[model samples]
Target: MQECLGFYAWQGNWERLFGASFPQTTDQAGVAPLLSRVPVVWFSFDEAGNMTTQNAYANRPKGWEKMVDACRGRGIAVDMTVAYLDGPKLEKILADDSITDRIIAGIEREVALFDGVNIDLEGLGSKSVHQADSRTLVRYNFNRFLNKLRDRLQRLNKRLYVCVHPLNGWFLGYDYREIARLSDGLVVMAYHYGPTPEPYEPVEQSVTLALASGVPQEKLILGILTLKPYEIPETLAEKVGIAQKHRIGGIALWKISFLNEDFQAVLRRLLQIK
Candidate 1:
């Protein structure tokens, strides 16, 4: 089995993630038991690349620090994600040198608590209206920001992971080969594809695009949405299967809260756990 990275989302009002309704999984009692099963946990504690405030400080989940410490103590690689989904704003933020410097410095403070950081900047690339890659300015600024971030993380002995839109999608900002060359790796958010909530064609095409774009198969982590409109157990299982079939780096589940009974059963069977 490849690496299974679970995004532990408890940021802000959980009901509004990606502008969809989901049961508030942050405060659920059942989540305790599932904690031990996760091999790697990506902490999405609500960061928006803000220059005015440290968003993580206000939005972090209760006991999140302890969770990070405990996960690392268990030998699990715990990382954090900072997201900002506005293209215009994100492009502007990246375009400013002093602002980007402050943002990177602020991120360092949060990432020091984990194994690394995942830059979850969306919108910037997805705005090109079904074009090839990100806008040239967006591409240039974003990569430059990554370059500086990569250097900062290197000094802190932390890894940098970037979450990107699927190359097959209309979202444009991602330059996969360029991003792969600049950072440690990438998580392709190939979640909204469907003929039946979780079909396989888009994923196959995405993995194909990333590889053909010169991204190493081993460094590409396939990220998929496991809940919401996921009506059956096979939906989640099939998504994971695509990554395994391609022999990519791993699979990243959108969030862990939806690992309720039905999905847990599916997970156990796929992981071959007793």
Candidate 2:
């Protein structure tokens, strides 16, 4: 199967994603070089579970459409991520049946502008205290929401991707097996443990655990962080090798703005990006 290399570009880092020039010290002219190798780019410009308001894409950066069109022109898939900081909004939406249509309408409107959607519902893990019945309710409602969203995307002929934090499903209360089954794929966020970053051990363990949890390797996408002050080119390279060795679906980097010359060089060499 073909291996996918993906990257995330947040709203704050729109300059790096579409900027014409980059720091010369980074040995990079612009984002063009990186786009050649990356098949998918996830843009986190939409607020999570806030579909009641006007479409977020309407406020996108100037030339946003041109940028997306440029990406598409290169055979790259531009996906938007809908992320929730906490579970209350998501929980509230899941609790109410009447808002489902509105949510679906908002998503459809946004999906029409992109290749697909990535559902990133954070802060809903099992770390919090909840009664057995409440937990079951949350899980059921969340699953229902996903199923509905998946159905909508299917009807539109668009892809649906989900994000899985570093935590295990048992702790997060997310059914990864079912999530993998419901969406096009799952992005396993394997970074952001703490200030003092370790080598590739944490990522390897996370990937291994995800696989053990019944998430198919083929449906898994390993997510790595590219924040500064975490110099571990060798470790990052090793992780890429691991992903390839395991034959997982792909490898996704956290953000494009943090990428420097060294980092870009490493990625270009390992991923063989022209």
149 in model 1: Cα distance from truth in Å? 0.6
- Superposed Cα deviation of residue 21, candidate 2 (Å): 4.3
Clashes of 1: 4
Q: TM-scores across all candidates? A: 0.81, 0.81
Residue 158 in model 2: shift from native, Å?
0.4
Candidate RMSDs in order: 5.7, 4.3
Model 2: how far residue 146 lies from native, Å = 1.1
Every candidate's lDDT: 0.67, 0.65
Off by over 4 Å in 2: 1-28, 31-59, 131-133, 168-171
Give the lowest summed-lDDT range of ten residues in model 2: 21-30
* Candidate 1 lDDT by residue in tens digits, 200-273: 78777999989999999878988877676853677777877787788898777777666656776777676665
Predicted structure 2: lDDT: 0.65
Estimate the overall C-alpha local distance difference test score of candidate 1: 0.67
